[model samples]
Target: MAPLENLASGRGAFAPSSGEPASPSDGSGQSVGSGSSGRKRVPLGNSSAGGGSTSGNPAGDVGLGGSSGQPGNPDDPFILPQENASTLDKKLKVEVPMEIVVSCGPNGVVLHPGGYRISPGALKGKGAILAKELRSIVRLRQQVDPMIRPRPSIEFLVEPGGFDTYHEARRQTVISGLDWPVSLQVADTKVLDFFPGGRF
Candidate 1:
């Protein structure tokens, strides 16, 4: 634990119990004016054997072993320790892979290979004969073209501060002739496609 962590947890040198001040000593081997006020001056260091009660080590103070030590305060609010790398790795979610099929078809620009059935409201425009033929070719290639490998799926780490950027990028991938589907997974659960028409 650090000094700041001690402060945050209400434990460092400045933290006093019951709002009472910790008695301090003067440099001239004498008690401060706090003695006249009937306050007992707490020893800055551990006293000799059978001398007095102990308040434990202070933060950044050299201990009997000659190493700087952090004081432990049972009354301080508890702070959860940071997770180790292995623990964090076990808690991480895996990335999902998806496919985005784009083509100009009889139903206009197709964003998903599942056809208009997936996004009926989004399929607009009276496509020309050439567009219909293009759809046939695109379909044939999808079914038989062994050379056409699947495009790598896009990934989005669903953190609080990154949602807007991920949302905008997902929109662009569907509408800007980019043939890649977004991969979003959270806590081992796969999310459905909610941006097909790019409305949500």
Candidate 2:
């Protein structure tokens, strides 16, 4: 998705970024993660039922489509969606670190390291998004973008502000004013390791 420049008016929402081709689903309701694709799809279902497992191996044999149970990274940091089988839209809550940059982007506030977007209007007052570690709930819509994979849309539970930080595009340069418009480009790309090595 695109990034934002103006925080108050919500202006400068850049064009949605080009998406990567996602692996085709075989109607099994089992979303699998590929080895090279930097993307992982955790199938949505009720964990209590005979549906798939939420953690460990998502493609377990008891799920909608019975398979050999493909293995997934045990150390994966993401908390896959579960407990809701009614819709393709799901929410994944994550705690964002101050080290990762933030800006007004898709959803509302976009976090770096992963281009995770927050729900619109979730953030309260904001000078710069990277003031501290934030608890955010990310909305993930699987069916929205057919051409590309789904990215996390976040909604912060706490407000971020009252801290001085550098501009979005100009690294090491402090923002003249707290209310100045911040762009996604102002994010420090050098420190963040995004998909494909950089460029989120």
Instruction: Identify the candidate with maximal lDDT.
Output: 1
* TM values, all candidates: 0.20, 0.16
Task: Give the range of the ten consecutive residues with the poorest summed lDDT in model 2.
Answer: 162-171
Give candidate 1 regions above 4 Å deviation. 1-91, 107-200
* Superposed Cα deviation of residue 58, candidate 2 (Å): 73
- Candidate 1 lDDT tens digits, 83-148: 898666545633333444333222233334444321222333233322243345445644564434
Report the error of model 1 at residue 174, Å: 9.8
Task: TM-score for candidate 2, please give it.
Answer: 0.16
Model 1 poorest ten-residue lDDT run = 116-125
* Backbone clash pairs in model 1 (N, Cα, C under 3 Å; residues 3+ apart or in different chains), count: 0
